[model samples]
Target: MDASVRLHLLKSCISYATHDHVRKSGHRASMPPKALLLTSQPSLRNVVSRAWRAATSITPYQTSCFKPNKNWTLRSIDHGARPYSAKTKPTVSAVLKNIKDHTAENIVSIFHSRSNNPYHNLAIENYLLRNSHAQSKILLFYTNRPCVVIGRNQNPWLECNIAKIQEGLPWNAADWDDGVLDNDRHVIAEERDGYNVSLDLVRRRSGGGTVIHDVGNLNFSFIVPNDKDFTRDKHAELIVRALMAPMTVTRFRDHVLYDNVHVNQRHDIVMTCANVDGGNTQKEFKVSGSAFKLTRGRALHHGTILHSSPNINRQVFVAGDEGGQVAASVFSALLSSPAKPFLEAKGVGSVRSPVHNLFDVTDQVQRREVVRSLRKEIGQLFMDVNGMGDISVEEVGDEDCAVDMNGEIYRDAQELMTDDWRFCQTPTFEYRSEDAGGALKMRFQVKHGLIQNASLEHVELDAEQQLKFAGLEGKKLHEIQSWTSCLPPHAGFRHAKACAHLETVFPKIQPAGAAREGGAESTIIQEADLSGSNQDGIAVKRKAPGGRIELERGGENVVVER
Candidate 1:
């Protein structure tokens, strides 16, 4: 991303947000993913031309999602992020108006997400809010391919598994991943200079910690005007109530580590919560994390409900090893602690990430089928809450609602994807590594995604050598990982090794809090049998430096398993 290149892209990619006053047709070209968008935007002509030439000779990969049917019709059903020709289908407005005409008071809108691209999806979410009137509330059901999304104000480097994200960085496989699931994207990504996956770390315009979404996981968001209570706790409870799950609704507490992760068999989100008692509340863990964004008089309270775990979960580290220990402990505690509607099903896939990111009982295909069933249940729940005994479901192509005539959507998405928003918002913290595992001690200050000050220390380094690491003051962490080739040519081999190692471990962002100080101190429990490990009530705890720093936001804390 060069300055000029990013600018050119921003100027070229149209924003999907459109004004209702300017009514326009909602038809988009069939998504070969890259072909139509590239062809439409002049700047992408060269890239697409080169890509097509290269891709034409390189046989196309048929992605499972893109498996097209020759007999497909405009009325064909689209289950996941697939596209179909809809030229013959009725317009989105025509169908939406039909629903609106029949329904009254608390008019609810439902949409199925068809884009695996988080940027595109997030943009669409905003579009719903930005385009709709205050009279109606919107519910969007979406399943992402594989993407890590963080809150608006949080730091990406602090919240994400940056090391893994960096390893799969430059995902230029648009030509390969086109609506078709062959092994091409995997082959091209893996063999294209040693990257295994093409990844994007997205930031949402809401307040919450990190969340990872994949096809196995189904996400729903609600956008409503501010006519009633808009408190954060109520938002969390609303989701719990709607889903008809027994998981208690809670908030963050003082002296508690704000590991703002969703509490599940595998804790991966951060939130503040506690169970109510006689004027007292039991320590609460997070299952669903809700963040809010107030635009005009309306507020968008969107949250994630963990359904199935994805394989990437094993590689990500929220609080590194400690997060895992806490999740296992909480899950074990919940088994006998009288929490109703436990996700445990004896032999089905459990909700933890590290345990089984992949499907165990069935393949991803079957798992997705389960997700579809879950979506219907969610829809029924939505209707129940809104006092609607009956409601109609509309299935339309995302392109039907997506409008990118001017790339405003791209500009907004580009801003969200920048290094500044991702890492710069991280709270100032110090890192002191121990010699126990070839760790390096360091203190850092990053703002606007740029390193203002950084100092690293290794046992072998002298005072001068210690300061050598300070030469990287102005570099960004994302850029630092790729700087291996640019190490000082004149530096001694030993010095080069240290710098390289420094770069490798530099972004291992740890919590700065020392309160409660260790894993399982906040809560005690066992690794539940949910993950199919079949070992019931195994005590889960571990010791880590900085004691898995606990944070308190408003009132909730997210503790992870070690």
Candidate 2:
């Protein structure tokens, strides 16, 4: 017979057996054998199956719903009742007094919530919150269906796709049931009627090492080993690790259900970040109570979990490379250490510095001042990286380079050549020049830092002239120019090369021996020469006959015989 026919026959036989028992117990059975039994013909089988189901209210054992025990008499109830005082109650006061009594005999019977399954991590957390005095908790979770949970230190969206869930193909879903069906016992109880159920602690972690096993039909429970249980830290770490773990996509073929009832997608890998900074920092911890954002947006509220270290800032971010978050946290903790009274004298508040220390400080106050200054500087330092066209590197003499107020070298000044250069609020490079009198002058600017900015002390095969005539070749230079042009005419930084070139080419035309001279580093373009003469040596002179005369050498009409 086919599977469906066999199923119908087995259901009929079970119904017959139930009715037989009712008849023997002197109760009139509603179901008849002819109606309960299936026939060889498909149509007859269906008609009989329907008639039997309609006649008898006997639900199969498999689909039995839980109902409260209402038929028990007072005598039967009394037999099950036990005195609360006589029964061993793990009291809050008793657990506290026995925490330090680790002689293996003091808190011998005091096991917290006797459960051992690692999947109970979430339940353990809830247990801890409810009984404030409960020493600790163990979580136990069991399922024929497989699943993968995220880490405590990770951004979920970057780790997994939410749009997929909205698309109905939730990265995690099942075939037998909708992916969002409630798996909670209370929810299940409310949905299914008529059930009396009791939960008892089944699995446990005692004096032995971690054990993994299936203890048939028993409800998994948690156990707090002793007063000096390390589960608290371990559980916290596990939670952090889970939350911070990276998100991943996978198929359910691996951890398949045995009965195939709760068929689901099972991911083998735990998607959590391994790095210490994989989670959130102190600043991000209190934002929205979320470990990460769903999308990249300016969220008014967001949150993260940080590794709280007493030695460092307890609230450091855990989402950057280099583990800088943890390191900065450590430094912050030391700054606010009670043993260090000297830091307090400097008038710096105890708030931990969020970013790495970028400035040198002699004391706590100086450190905080440096941090404050750094914060203020960062606010002003807004660079629209997208607005930047192209990037090129140039080495101005080592002396030409100077750290900005924020201490970052704005080496690529040419990037600022775009018209919106004013958008680059960060001080990148500072320019310094000397006059013939030895007085030094300075101007602040940024560079896409092209080779043209470098100074040549002497001519080598006349490379300077070749380069000047060659003009800028890099695509980056052109891009910067293009971007700069898009801004207002005067918005961006002017290349110093323009002014320096004018200075160098100007002095060579001075009358012999009349050239302005001084510091070799300074060009001889004095004030008077700048206001006169074109490069063709056309000297503008006042004529003896009242009008100004433009004079040039080799002119045929020049007949003045002085």
lDDT of 2 by residue, 1-562 (tens): 2345335344644555455445545443222222113233446544544444454443331121111111110000111212122333422323322333421322112122222222232233222223223333222222211111223221111222111111111111111111011121111101111221111111111111111111111122223433433322322233223322222001212211111111012101112212225434222111001111111211111111111111222242222334344423422221222112111111111122132111122232232232222212211121111122221111111111112211111222222212122112211232223231222121212243232432222223254452342232232221232322221222122334433322321111111111111111222333233243333333323222211121232221111100
In angstroms, how far off is 98's CA in candidate 2?
Answer: 18
Backbone clashes for every candidate come to 52, 54
Instruction: List candidate 1 stretches off by more than 4 Å.
Output: 1-106, 168-195, 231-287, 310-361, 393-406, 425-444, 454-474, 481-494, 506-562
The CA lDDT at 392 in model 1 is 47
- Local accuracy of candidate 1 as per-residue lDDT tens digits, 434-552: 33134334444454556544445433455445435455545665566443543343332344554555554443332211121112233432333112222221122422231221111
lDDT for model 1 comes to 0.42
Give the CA lDDT, 0 to 100, for residue 30 in model 1.
Answer: 17
- CA displacement after TM-score superposition, residue 39 of candidate 2 (Å): 33
